[model samples]
Target chain A: MNKEVLKALERDARTTPEQIATQTGISMEEVEKTIEKAERDRVIVKYKTIVNWERLGEEQVQALIEVKIQPQRNVGFDAIAERIYRFPEVRSVYLVSGTYDLAVFVVGKTMQEAAAFVWQKLATLESVQGTVTHFLLKRYKEDGEILEGGGEKGRRQPLTL
Target chain B: MSPRPGLNSKRARSLISKRVEGISPSGIRKFFDILSTMEGAISLGVGEPDFVTPWHVSEAGIYSIEKGYTMYTSNKGLLELRQELTRYLYTRYGVEYDPETELLVTVGVSEGLDLAMRSIINPKDEVLSPDPTYVSYGPCTVLAEGVFIPIPTTVENDFKVKAADIEKRITPRTKAILLGYPNNPTGAVMERNELAEVAEVARRHDLLVVSDEIYDRLVYGVKHTCFASLPEMKERTVLLGGFSKAYAMTGWRVGYAAARHEIIEAMTKVHQYTMLCAPIVAQMAATEALRAGDAVVKEMVADYDRRRRVMLKGLNDIGLACFEPKGAFYCFPSVKVTGLSSEEFAEQLLVEEKVAVVPGSAFGECGEGYVRCCYATALSDIEEALRRMGRFVERHS
Candidate 1:
């Protein structure tokens, strides 16, 4: 499964093939081949940096927009799901097993921009019964990273205890 | 100013046990003293996870407190907790242990190590362990009045203590072999077949084996075979494990020791007198850790695996010859390329670049030309440390 090369790239896409070989104890040629194949197959979709936008004063406005849609004549949620996900503002779309039909994460630069996209584009779509938008007020965590708690810092610098 | 109260007090020194006095102080202490005084020094020396106990486990502790379950637990710790450990050990290693008499919840694997040493080691009995093991093993053995014998290992053989070497060192007085795999400074692990060889030696010699598997779950590219799971070895092996490394529960002070009933009984007697019990609240949290913390542990290990890749590649790329460490969060890179002793390299690197790494000599004499750099830090910090180390190495060269 070339787990070593895939894991290395998943951690940091910037890691060179030589580094992956050294890290995984694999030959450089093997690492290069696995990575090339993975890239060609689209198994490695993207390499991204986790940005703390708040520190840069570019706090993004994010909202979870839950949608309830009527089943179509034949295609059901997939037809409307494809249409909603096609929008540039939609970050993620999920057919949740819950009170809602589809849950989508929408991001914009400002609250007004997010509301405009919802009111202008989403509400007017065919078979989109209604949408409940919840604006994110804070982020204590993101993408499995804790954004808060600098950690109650009174620990003495340990001498290998 | 007048001299401090115990600055030169001979009597005060004598008041400490002779065994404790006999043990040498840590060689890394002087460097750490300077590192502590220096401001803005980034340390890659601490051998611990950067993550705190997962929120769900912490919440369970708080919930137990809210329910007022604040009372002294049994000396062997909570039955519920021990039973959970039983199930866990069984599932992970296929080893069955009786919950009531064969398991003792301890105050971290540190306590379990001490208890195992004290319970079995009579005065002047010898215990064989690898050199450059966790710092506490030798001291713990000495504290129990047993002689600590270091079986030296080099970067060769992937730093695994050879079974032949261990057999050669055994004498009539040798009572036990102490091992920690997925090891600390070197991050060495033994393959199952290799461990079975050691188990064969122990069986032949009729020696007790205290195996510390605290870093059992931290392995990459290898499976950690529980020593007690070996054929007919359950009765002879004291399996020590804990939540500190795997569950990021260092502050909770919860761990376990499982063996035959005789050993657990002896250990519980010492544990009862000394520790009373592992904190009850922490026990509740540990119960929750066993029940729901598997996914969290997997996530944390995934994070460590990525860090391992970066740290190993970065050190080797910087011209420090480091073998790929398959377990734990440390990268032990040889600093011989700079022609500087590990101690000198650690000190100068800290002073010049404001980055701190542990001199490997602090682990053992055989660890002299290497440094232990932990990767359980922010990736940015690790990268920055590597850059500074590269500059330091360049200047030295």
Candidate 2:
């Protein structure tokens, strides 16, 4: 696979295959073939956008829950992680190191809904021993992107020496 | 009633010094003045990178302020920054310099250029430079009371100034040869063998060589040859480099000059007297750039390469014949198809299409008939600008 084409897509998924070919010095057919193969093999899992819901006044409440869980026979934490991740409210699940065996990112329309998911659903899991929920207060950055104050206005003048 | 008599226009004009008076304003100044008032204009005019200085580098500078390191550095520069810069040069170019003696950091490559001119030039001493060069080279020499001789370079030669062409302009009073490559205006990079020949010419003429390598790190595919790295040339060459183009640190105003101790001492004398030092904050930032900014520069170079391809292909497809610019983020496309002079084409394009580009003649006489389109803007802007230019070209051609 052409790693350059993949990198270009990773940076901006909207970049056309034609642009990728030109940018990476690959032939158009070759770029298309590589991208097709990558998608089929699930190398490119998703083409996603990072939207600022706060700007739209539709900000969703989110919280991180550190869960202490008992290991199942021969499965370690994988079975528990899979069960937690399968929940609709869970945004992400990690088999973490340290005091907690699992870290779950739970999102809901409201803080009460998120807390309900943590208490009624997550804390009552068969293997879950205890949990600590840290509700996200405000996001300055998310997914490697700054959330605010980055305007598209040009900084330098139109002419220079 | 006549006690408050005022000088007339001619008398007032005559009151200015001959040196400053001889230097006319930049040819494109009036054009840019018009551009400043026009809203919704997309510019491919300025040579600066569109990217902000990498956050980590800026944070390092800001961190210094938090730690209360805001005082001016030494007249030469911060010792650590100088050492870091010299080490970078040595490791990358295999050219060694004594940081304490041979390096003097100035405000920017702008100041580095000015310092080199003032240090080496005497009255009537001619400095030969490639035509269609950076805007400051000739004016700086002239300000130093030196004659600025232009060696006319053309598209036929791919804008690389030849040693023989440079030799033709030499005379008894010629004291230096000035070169800026991976050049601005033309985006021409002189190959190593070609520069070895120029080094030979300098040796034969026993002339000082001032090489402006501000865009050195921005070259594509091909490697950049440091002028001082040439055999027996370092002693006589004034090497000027900066973090502006490569590191996107133009507003920081920090650059450096490297040479033999004697020449550097002379430059430092002038620098200390006129401007005491480069801002300490800038030096700290430059030090961070040298230490950890390579990956950032590499990523930027790749991005510029992509934009360069899009621009070169788009311009050629639209009938504006353009040479492949292998360095810097610019495409110097000949606007000859439009049947208008470069200035006329630029003015009409801005007014008619709201697309701004610098007219080639603003660089030098040989730069006529072409316009420099910087590809450092966003990909979307470049594509849009090309569309507007295509329409403009179709109508004019």
Candidate 3:
């Protein structure tokens, strides 16, 4: 099982355990067990997707949702935000000091959807008192990559069959 | 104090070199750098049109030089050109400005942006803009010592910034708003009604509006609206426009800004100190562009619209979810099926498939799970790129 997991990582960190088993001649059960252990031991920190939002006409609208929450008796603000993050729309949540208690990142299908998510969902939470959303006007870089650095490098090549 | 030679060795200015430290060399540039060095890479990441400068436009510049009109003109540019600009704006978008007082020719829209920020931004003042927008705004604001306040517009509603959303982000420090129509990355355009809504908010807040309309002529079905053209916005709005995108004169570096006399005066002071004026020959070429360039612009827009349709249809056919872009030549598609982050997907496509694309995250944080594909390439190239992308998706799936 350990050898199978090793082979899978070597092939592609993005490959799933189910795929690993099929490719490495290992049972799915053993692959899953090995993957669980690897994750528990901090080998795989995360899994992510790279989307071409431009192609989907999906403009990436990011706003810092500053939340001022009413701290619960025993649970505190952290507990309240944890509950808020359960929504798939919430991308990231942080405990911040100063004027706001929490900074949340939310995604929506449109400008209106993002606004609705904040006004109707996140803002309506019982513990929430006030919310301020700052929408990103443009993105120069995200996760350490540039968007419009020019020439052929800036071009998006078509996929081959 | 002078006795210890090692104790005071200039401290090397705290560690990171200033050149490499604050200047986060454009992420797009770095990606291209990597691509240039790699083998078998085909890229559709560039933002501008692939067409060369129209022949008539180039001829105008050459004519100016042949006629010995190479000397510097007035700081506000040739009167004939400014008047032509005034007429062009009025006819094209219903925008009005006193060309003599309100307009200042600059090197490009890039310089206009830099000049606007340099003129209006007091240290720590806030400049509001939309997210996943053109890449230069935030960095320019920072370089001008102004705080950049980004308002994110998402994929769902075609990436338009709502007036209510804009209102919520305003604060005492908010001094201005930067508006880009026929926007970059998302290809979102604001109709007249939408511009009016934004104009009302700016008026109430007493905010200065910097309107970037470089892609004005590229709108497919929608009419492009200028914020300054609205009733009250002209007084508070600085109009940034250029010939690069429309005339395919990018390398010529010619653009102009129109604003209230006072604002123009301030921008000119900065412009005079930094750039003097746009190139003389280029200005002559632009003058001709303002006059006879309309037909050329129309022809290019028609071609782009056709290509845009082809690419959009191809993307949807390939099972990738894409929004219909109203302006500009880009398509932002969601790459969720592969379960790879924008960067991972881009890297793999480049390395394994030889297809080059920019990760959406390179645009901003919300740009994760996406990539921007420019349709400026030829139809055949776009078709090939889509096919390669479909195969890449299948391989990962």
DockQ of each: 0.28, 0.67, 0.02
Judged by whole-model lDDT over C-alpha atoms, candidate 2 comes out at: 0.92
Clashing pairs in model 2, backbone N/Cα/C closer than 3 A: B107-B253
Q: Model 1: residues >4 Å from true position, as ranges?
A: A1-161, B1-11
Each candidate structure's TM-score, on Cα atoms with residue i matched to residue i, is: 0.85, 0.97, 0.68
Compared with the true structure, what per-residue lDDT tens digits does model 3 show for residues B1-397? 5775564446754565653367565566556667777776667787777887877888999999999988977877788888988998888768787887988888889999999999999989999888777778888888888888888788886778878888999999999999888878778888888878889999999999999999988998778887787897789999999998999888788999999999999999998877887889999889888888577888788768766876777777776778888898888888888889988988888778777777777666767787888888776677788889888888887
Candidate 2 lDDT tens digits, B82-130: 8998899999999999999999999998999999999999999999999
| lDDT pick, better of 2 and 3 | 2
Model 1 over residues B1-397: C-alpha lDDT tens digits?
9976755688778789876778998777787788778887888988788887888998999999999999999999999999999999999999999999999999999999999999999999999999888899999999999999999998988789889999999999999999999888998888999999999999999999999999999999789899999999999999999999999888889999999999999999999999999999999999999988478898888778867887888888889999978888899999999999998999899999998889998888888999999988887788899999999989988
Best-to-worst ranking by lDDT: 2, 1, 3
Higher lDDT: candidate 1 or 3? 1
Off by over 4 Å in 3: A1-161, B1-20
**What is the full ranking by DockQ, best candidate first?**
2, 1, 3
**Candidate topping lDDT:** 2
Error of 1 at A103 (Å): 4.9
Q: How many steric overlaps are in each model, in order?
A: 0, 1, 72
